[model samples]
Target: MPAARPPGGVTVRRLTARDARALTTLPPAMSWIHRTWGGPEALARSGCAWAAFQGDRIVAVACTYFLGTTYEDVACVTVPDPRLQYLALDCVDALCADMAARGHTPSWTCSTSNRPGRLLAWTAGFRPEREYAHYAVGAPAATGRAAAG
Candidate 1:
């Protein structure tokens, strides 16, 4: 990485198990990352995760496990607070760059209905690899407001 300073005195670092707690505070839906793979155990397994911290606080996070020139299973979640959006993008940039450096062409995916997800993926340089109709059953009724469960 370059010595150039990013805005808001933000800095990026590899996320460790230590970050799991703080990451879990981001919002319930956002907590899935920590719940699933943000802890030390997952990091000890097949993949790596990274975060952007503002001083001692985690502002953004990204994790990529599956690796391939064509696709990878990636999870990206940021603090829901809008003030943190820039930091999220910064973390994403670093993640993509690092993956490219490692000889893998990283790609991302989102459900066709996830508008913001699609927007974020496109802005981050991932193109549509494929799309398919998905079916769901026994799920709660969809609501524009996030589900509380």
Candidate 2:
């Protein structure tokens, strides 16, 4: 299926090196564009990412953040603005469609508390497949596991 049409005044396209500046404006929580893809420079080079923009401002982005044996981990975020409704969905739909064309299954994950993300995934036909928890721990400590000989 063709991707849903983005909202008027919003345009979606493949992420490029020029977007590095706009990507920097995202807050830490939306830093997946950095942490997962090693910043906009890398993501642009990967050619597996897309962004929604209103002129020079990046309003949303969807990217394959991880690659498993048979699926691509999908991540997306939109600027926090109520007026930008449907913006993220449009961006995600376009990205998912492109991934499908490339034969990559998309795996989307988000904290259960993220209602907006969940809703967007749902709207994009993604259903829950598994549930897991992640923790932010301090510096790694070595466990006393003897090496197998």
Candidate 3:
């Protein structure tokens, strides 16, 4: 698929192992990639990462994880620059197209609290598949009981 051409001179391209350092510059919200995928090195090796470049700096990134023979889970993060916000959707679009060509369906799991992410997913033509609650198990509460209880 052809890359997205955002106005204002931004360029989008696939990210590789060489771009690991750039991944580090992403905001904290995107740090989950490091924790879940074993940092930029693993992400680079996944052969499914893409980014938007503004000159020598990385302004946005999108990646996919193959869940099975038929589905790929997509995620993305972008700099807070409003002028460049659209870049995230563009990157995802490119990734989705690439996935389709390879016979894998692209799917997105978005946080309801993340309005921008929801918007981006919708703009990229993703619709709600199903709804499920997400829970995090953290340190014990002061009473030493399960947080849910």
Off by over 4 Å in 1: 1-5, 38-41, 44-47, 65-70, 139-149
Tell me the spans in candidate 2 whose CA falls farther than 4 Å from its real position: 1-4, 135-149
Write the candidate numbers in order of decreasing TM-score. 3, 2, 1
Error of 3 at 15 (Å): 0.7
TM-score computed on alpha carbons, candidate 3 = 0.80
* CA lDDT of every candidate: 0.67, 0.80, 0.79
lDDT per residue (tens digit) for residues 1-149 in model 2: 33457667888898878778878877767877657777767887677878888888888888887877678878888888876777777777778887888888987988988987898898889999888888888877655655332
Model 3 alpha-carbon miss at residue 140, Å: 7.5
Q: Residue 102, candidate 1: how far off, in angstroms?
A: 2.9
What 10-residue stretch in candidate 2 is worst by lDDT? Answer: 140-149
lDDT of 1 by residue, 8-104 (tens): 6677777765665556556666666655544435652433677877777667788785655665556687767765565656667777877777777
Ranking by lDDT: 2, 3, 1
- The lDDT, on a scale of 0 to 1, for candidate 3 is 0.79
Q: RMSD in Å for candidate 1, one decimal?
A: 6.4
lDDT of 2 at 45: 67
